[model samples]
Structure formats: structure tokens, C-alpha cells
Target: MKEKITYQDAGVDVKTGYEAVKKMKKYVEATKTPGVLSELGSFGGLFQLDLKGYKQPILVSGTDGVGTKLKIAFMMEKHNTVGIDLVAMCANDVLCQGARPLFFLDYIGTGKLDSNQAAQIVEGVAKGCKEANCALIGGETAEMPGFYEKGEYDLAGFCVGIVDKDQIITGKDIQPGDVLMGLPSSGLHSNGFSLVRKLFFEKEKIKVEQYLKELGDTLGNILLTPTRIYVKVILDLLERFSIKGLAHITGGGFIENIPRILPEGCRAYIDTDSFPIPSIFTLIEQLGRLEKKDLYHTFNMGIGMIIVVDPKEVDPITKFLENKGEEVYEIGKVGRGEKGVEL
Candidate 1:
């Protein structure tokens, strides 16, 4: 008789998947908020909206993945922090709309399931959810044989947030003479990695373990720093300040993102010297011989989040943010011109 085949033989292991779910359960539970109605294994996540103070509640949703930055995580063999990047990418986008993140779900696709590694990744997701004041209600782990390479996986996240209709920051109020304040970035914050990898690995042929004086750490460590989640601070600011517009500096950087919140007749004038650019960006520019416009067009260049506010309120807002230990900079101002950013 011919030997019987099993799902394991086909490269999908049900038992291993069960083990991974088992290992990740605690991390998932730790992120539970009052609104989360379903457990981690539920078919769909359930969040009870507390509409106590909201007259017209609006739901804001965002989804994103950690692009080629995953390559750096793969090189470092560290799986913990990438999940945080996955959550931050989605949460920060939702935050730009002035929403309070309620819950988050993550998806992991890989050739094989490693329970320990999967658990590590989920731990980071839970940590990020806690920081963002959201719940990690549900997620999926797909094991597809021959789909992804060995020891490699892809991650994506979905975030849902709530905002009152009147409280939604639509950037419609952004006008000429608005002061633009910036929140400093914690390194690259998970964008422009394709260019970064080419410069460091392909062109310069530098190893991840190599230490540089400028960065003050190993390339892998610096590159693998997780994206920052500004949800908590921004939410607090919303309550006490008259924030006109918010821009989460992501893939497009200053040139593309800043214009997103600009009004029709308003343009953004950024003083390049207003905030100090991180050394890693300077290194990339020097190594790649890139132009100023191209660098600002691609990476955050140092500022992660920009706040557009009434010029009169700048002093109070700056004081409030600084007391919270944020490295705030009065980076620029909105001016009367075409709808774009000028550096």
C-alpha cells in the first residue's frame, strides 16, 4: 500500500499553527481594552463604541505594511520590533484624521510557522497596541508552502479608530500664517528602506553588524528601530489645543505629505535649519550623493510629525509638548502661495 499523505507533508502544519496561537494568546490578552468584545481567535473583532460624548461618531480606518524595512529585520534575525512597525504604520495614519484608535488586527504570511518567533512578533504588536491605547483583538497567521522563502514572512496591520464628526481634523482650517511645529523622529521610522538597503548593502557593501561613529550603533540596530506611534500625545493635544492640521510624515516625507494638509491657497515654507537632521540621513545623502530635494522627498529627514496651529497658540502648544518630553521644533509656517511645500 502507498503511504498516506498529510497536510504536514504539504508544508502546512495544523499542530504548529495551534501551538503558535497558544503561545501568542497571553500577548493578545494583555492588550485588551474595555471595548474589545471578542477574543484573539474570534472570526471577527468586536469593539463596543462608547458613544457617550459623541454626537455623530465617525469611524476612521487605516491599513499599511512595513515595506522593505522587513529586510533589515531579517538581516538582524530580530523578530520582536517589526510588529510594532506594522502597528505604528496603520495607527499613525488613522491618527492624522484625529481618531482614537480602538482596536488593531495583524496578518502574518509565511512558508512555515515558528511558534516562538510568531509569539515574539505578537508581543511587539501587543506592546504597540498598549502604547496606542488600542486592543489587539484578532489576527491571522497563514502558512503557505512555496509562497514565501524559508525564514521569511510578510506582515500587515489594520487599525480602526473613532472620532466625533465635529472633532475630525480635516485640514480645512489650515490657512496662511499658521505655525508649523514638528515632532522629532526616532531614526528612520520605517520608510525609504529600499534606497537605504541599496546604499548600505548593495552599493557600500556594509554589514549590518558594522558600527559607525556617526550613528553610534550598529547599522542593523539603528535601521531596525520601530516607527513611533504619536496617538497618545496627539490625542492629548487635541483636547487642549486648537490644532489646525496634522501630517504624519511617512513615505512622501516633507515635499509630499506636508502639501496633503495644505489649503488651496496656502503653501508650506519649511526652514531646513529649523530642526537638526539625524546623522543616518546625512550619511545616506553623502554616500549616495543625493540632492536635497530628493532626500526631503523620500525620507522624514528627522521630523516625524508636523503640527499646524494658529500662530498665537504656538507658545502654549510648544510649552505643553516640551513638558511631555517631546523634542519639539518650530519647523516652518503656512504662507499664501500655491498648494505645496517649499524648503
Candidate 2:
């Protein structure tokens, strides 16, 4: 008799996938709010937009992945923090347009699903959604046996938000005499990890668990630090301040991201010494022998989100943010120049 074929034999376990989803339900329920109308296992996530306060409600959506930082997560066998990075990458982007994040969805694909690991990863995502005050409506967990290595996986996130048409903070209004206020990052905030892996794992052969005096933390812990979610803080500032432009510093670093929100004939003159950079960056620079330009172009360099406001509002805004338990930095000012960032 011919051997019977099964989905499990092909490396896909419907049972395990269902179990993983089952494990994620509690985390999903933790992010529920008034607008969430769909349950965790629904065919589609339903979020009834609550626009009672807005004259013109505009939807803002952003999608992003953790990028090569997932590699670090895999290397350390730490699946938790990368999910937070996934949500942070998307949530922060939508907030740039002055939107209040409403709901979020996630995607996780792996060669073979480990129910426990998948649950841990989704736990992080739910935590991040809670931090952003967004609902974790629904998401996908795919187990494709041959696509990814047995122990490897990839993650991504999508976030939707709503903003009033009149309140959109496009960079068009950014002009000279505007102050650039920076919110400190928790750490790397999930970018530029390809180079990081090359330096630490490929070239130096440093073990992920190795402890360093300068870092005061294990290499794995520092590298796996969860990305910061700025939705609550930024939303609070929006209510009280006239923010001209907002920039979520991600992969492009200062050189690339700052220019995105600069209007024509406007330039960002950044003072490198305006704030203290986390020691992780300095250690990377010293160990990798990377140049200053490369460092600023690749990583957050300790500054995660940049807020542009009128110069006169700088003191009050800084004080407001500081009072809210945020580390605020007057990193730079908008100037009339060639429409680029100058460090």
C-alpha cells in the first residue's frame, strides 16, 4: 500500500497553528477598546472609526517590518522584543501625520511554527498595541515548512490611524525659525542591523551573550531592546502644542529622515552635542570603526522622534515633554538654507 500523505508531512501543521492563535487570544483581548468590533479569530478585523470629534476624519496607514533586526532576535533566540519593534515601526510612522492610531495587525511566517514561541512574539505585539492605545484586531501566523529555515521567521506590522484634515502635520508648513525637539530613543529602535551583524558576528565573532563593561548589559539584551512607542507622548503633545512637522527617525537616521519633513528652502541645523547619545552607539562606532556620517545615517543615535515647533514654543514644549517623563533634547533648529539637514 502507498504511504498516506498529510499536511504535517509537508511541514504545515494546522493544529499547531490553531493552538498558536488560541494562545494569542488573551493578549489580543488586552488591546481591545470601544471601537474594536471583531473578535480575534474573525475572517477580517473590524474597527469602527470613531470620528465624533473630528470635522474631517482622514485615515492614515503605515506598514513596516523590523528589518534585519529580526536576525539579531533569531540569533539570540529571543522572539519577544522583535514584535514590539514591528509595531513601533508602523505606529510611529502614522503618528508623524498627526493621526491617532486606531488598530494594528501583525504577520508572522516561519518554516515550522513553535506554538510557545509564536505566543511569546504575539505577546510583545499586544503589549506594543496597548502602549500605542491601539487595538490588536487580528493578524496572520503562517507556517511554511521550506520557505524559512526551521528555526527562522520573519515579522511585519500594519497600523491604521485617523486624523483631522485640518490637523495634518505635513512638512509643507515647516519653515526657518522652527526648533527641532528630539525625544530620546530606547535604544536602536530596529534599524541598521545588517551592518551590526557584520561587525559583531561576522567580523569580531563576539558572542551574543557576552557582557561588556561599557554597555553594562549583555550584547543580546542591548541589541534586542524593544523599540519605543511614541504614540501616547506625541498625541499628548499634539493636544497642547502646534507641532509643525514630525519625523520618526528609523532606517535613514538623522541625515535621511530629517530632510523628509523639511520644506523647500528649509534646512535642519543639528547640533551634535545638544544631547547625550546612548553608549551603545559609541560602542558600535568604536568596535565597527564606522565613520560619523555612516553612524548618523544608519542608526537612531539616541534620538528617536523629532518634533518641529516654532522657536518661541521650544521652552514650553520642552518643559511639557520633560514633565511627561520624556527625555527632551533641543537638538537643532530649522534654518533657511538648501532644504537639507546639516550636522
Candidate 3:
């Protein structure tokens, strides 16, 4: 008889894939929300819309990947926290439109299947879903042997949210004299890692385990810190305040992201000294010999999210956010003449 080559011989292992699914089930179950109508293994993620208070309900969707930050996770041999980064990158963007995140789905592509590692990654995802008040409906785990490196994997996420049309923040109302408030970021929050990697690993030749007194943590730990989800606080603010505009500081940093919501003839004037910049950013700036403008144009610095509101509403909003344990800073003000950001 001719030799028979099984599917497992070709690199994909069905049995191992099944084991991974079994390991991930419990973590997936913990993220269930009322809107989730399907299980983890379904053909599609099902979320039943709850249109109780919304008259003209609008659906907002966002998708993002962790980018080169995954390289750091690979170096640290840590598989958990990147899943949270995956969810936050998407959920935070959807929140910019003043939407409540309803459900999330993730994708994991790897060369070989490791059940424990897959479970750990999903556990992080579930934890993030709980924090964001969203459900983990469904996802994919692809095993392609030759396509990826042995111990490395890629992760991406999709988030769906809902908001009423009238409640949507379009920044159309942003005018001169409007106050800009900022919420502090946890750390690097998963952007500019390509430059970071070059500065630390390639140029400075710093090891991941190296400790820095300025940051008070190991280099790897600071770089791997998960992105913060602003859904809950922003949603609460929407109910009690007239928020003119919202911006989630992501890949573009302050220079690019803040202008995204600015209306015609309105510019943002940010007082950079208003908030304390995180040490990790400063380290990158010094090591890379980058200019101040380059740093703000590439990283979030310290501010992760920005809220635009009328000057009259700043005091009350700041008080409410402070009461919620958020570090609030009166970062800037909207100005006339141009449609961009001024540091």
C-alpha cells in the first residue's frame, strides 16, 4: 500500500486544537453578557441588540491588532496580558463615538498549538471583557505550521458597541474656548513599540529583565503593561455631562489623534506641562535622542484619552472624574485659526 500522510503530519494537529478549545472554554464563559446569544464555538458571534432606551440606535465597530508589541511578549515568554491589549485597542476606539461595548471577538494565529498558552491568552481577554462590560462571543485559533515562528503568535480583536444617534459625540460642537481634559495612561499602552524595541533591544542592548529605578519595574513588565479601557468612565460622563467631543489617543499620539475630532477652524492648544509624563516615554526619548515634538507625535506621553467640553463644565466634570479615582488634568483648550493640535 502507498504511504499515507495524515493531516497532523502536514503540520496542523486537530487533536491539539480540540484540547486548546477545551482549555479555553471556562475563560470564555466568564465573559458572558446579556446580549451574547451564541457560544464560543459557533459559526458566528451572535449578540442580540437591547434597544430599551435608544430611539435611533447606532452600531459602532472597531478592529485593531497589538502591532509589534507582540515582539516584547515573545521575548518575555508571557502570553497573557497581550490579549487585554488586543481588547483595549478596539474597545477604546469604539468608545470615542460614545458607544457602550456590547461584545468582543479575538483571533489567535500560531504555528503550533499550546493548550496552556492559549488558555492564558483567553483568560486575559475574558478579564478585559469583564472590565469593559462586554461579552466574549466567539473567536478563531488558526494553526499553520510553516506560516509563523515556533513560539510566536499574532492576536487581533473586534469590538461592537451601541449608542443613540443624538448621543453620538461628533465634535461638531467643539468651539473656541472649550476646555480639554485628559485622563492619565497606565504606561506605554501598546503603541510605538517598533521604535521602542530599536532603542532598548537593538541600540542600547538592554535586556528585558533589567530594572530601572526611574520606572520602578523591569523593562519588560513596563512595556507589556496592558492598554486601559475607557468605556465605563466615559459612558458615565456622557450621562451627566455635555461632552462636546472625545478622542482616544492611539497610534498617532496627541498630535494626530486630538485633531481627529476637531471641527473646522478649531485648533487644540495643549499645555504639555499640565500632566506628568511617564518615565518610560522619557527613557525612550533620551535613548533615541528624539525631539519633544517627535515624542508627542509618536507616543501618548502620559495622557491616554482626551475629553472636550465647554469651559463652564470643566470644574464639575473634573470633580466627578476625580471622585471616580481617575487622574484628571486640565490639559488644554480649543482655539481658533487652524484645525490641528498645538503643543
The candidate maximizing lDDT is 1
Which stretches of candidate 2 lie above 4 Å from their native place? none
lDDT of 1 at 278: 92
User: lDDT by residue for model 2 over 70-137, one digit each (tens)?
Assistant: 88778888887787888999999999999999999999989999998999999999999999999999
Q: Can you list the residue pairs that collide in candidate 3? A: none
lDDT of 3: 0.91
For each candidate in the order shown, give its overall lDDT on alpha carbons.
0.92, 0.91, 0.91
> Tens-digit lDDT track for model 3 on 1-343?
9999999999889988889989999999999988888987889999899899999999999999999999998899998898898999999999999989999999999999888889989988988888899999999999989888988899988999999999888899999999999998988998999999989999999999999887899999999999998888988999999999999898979999999999989999999999999999988888799998899899999899999999999999989988888789999999996799998
Looking at candidate 1, what is the lDDT of residue 261?
84
Give per-candidate clash totals.
Answer: 0, 0, 0
lDDT of 3 at 97: 90
For model 1, state the Cα shift of residue 252 in Å: 1.2
* Candidate 2 TM-score, true structure as reference: 0.98
